[model samples]
Target: AQRVTQPEKLLSVFKGAPVELKCNYSYSGSPELFWYVQYSRQRLQLLLRHISRESIKGFTADLNKGETSFHLKKPFAQEEDSAMYYCALINGNEKLTFGTGTRLTIIP
Candidate 1:
């Protein structure tokens, strides 16, 4: 069974500080990885994808197939960036498995 795990339930940081959200997955076959973010009172939207190799909102995520990990990273955190982030993976069956998610709080 493919599963996505986000070890942290919450991550807090001050403005301008760096941020990193850890994510690990277990899957037998090749999986498509993505990071989704939901800001306050907003619907969830895609942040980045492993295949895109592009950064969005100053955030980037790299897929490490060997380690079965896709961690989200940002050099500087912003108050507006605070939100709930979920790591997801699409299995061979095209079913998306999402992590428990992490609530990011940025202190101004």
Candidate 2:
């Protein structure tokens, strides 16, 4: 079974500080990893994908196959960056398994 777990439900930090959102997954076969984000009232959008190796909105994530993790990271958090983040895994069937999600609040 493929599953994603986001240990933290909420992560609060001040603006301009580093932030790391933890994510762990379990899967038997090769999986595609992704990070999705939803701002206050906006639709969920793709933040980054392991295959793309691209960073979006100052955020980046690396797939750690050995540790079964894909943690999201940002060097400088911005107030506007505060939003809900979900870690997801695409299984062989192309079904995305999402974590409960973490609400990140960046204090100004």
Candidate 3:
């Protein structure tokens, strides 16, 4: 079984400050990592994926296999960035596991 862990349940950052949401996973096989975000009254959407290696909405996360971590980062957090962030993993079995999620609040 695969497991995903998000160390923080809530995170507050000042506008223009850097933000990081920690994520760690435990899986035996090579797995895919993804970051998902859900805005107010909106459906959960994909933010970024390890496979794509692209940045979305000024946020980026790198999969660290050695550390078993995929931490979401943004150099300068914007007010719009305040939302629910979830870290997910997909193992070889095609089962997706999601962390409890962290609610990011950008303070002005």
Model 2, residue pairs in steric clash: none
For all candidates in order, the CA lDDT equals: 0.95, 0.94, 0.95
C-alpha RMSD of candidate 2: 0.6
For model 3, residues 29-58, the per-residue Cα lDDT tens digits are 888999999999999999999999998988
| Colliding pairs, model 1 | none
Q: Please report how far candidate 1 places residue 99 from its true position, in Å.
A: 0.2
Model 1: per-residue Cα lDDT over 8-104, one tens digit each: 9999999999999999999988889999999999999999989999999999999999999999999999999999999999976778899999999
Q: Which regions in candidate 1 have their CA more than 4 angstroms from the true location?
A: none
Lowest lDDT block of 10, candidate 2: 88-97
The per-prediction CA RMSD against the true structure, in angstroms, equals 0.7, 0.6, 0.7
TM-score of each: 0.97, 0.97, 0.97
Q: Please, what are the lDDT tens digits per residue for candidate 2 over residues 1-108?
A: 788999999999999999999999999998899999999989999889999999899899999999999999999999998999999999878799999999999999
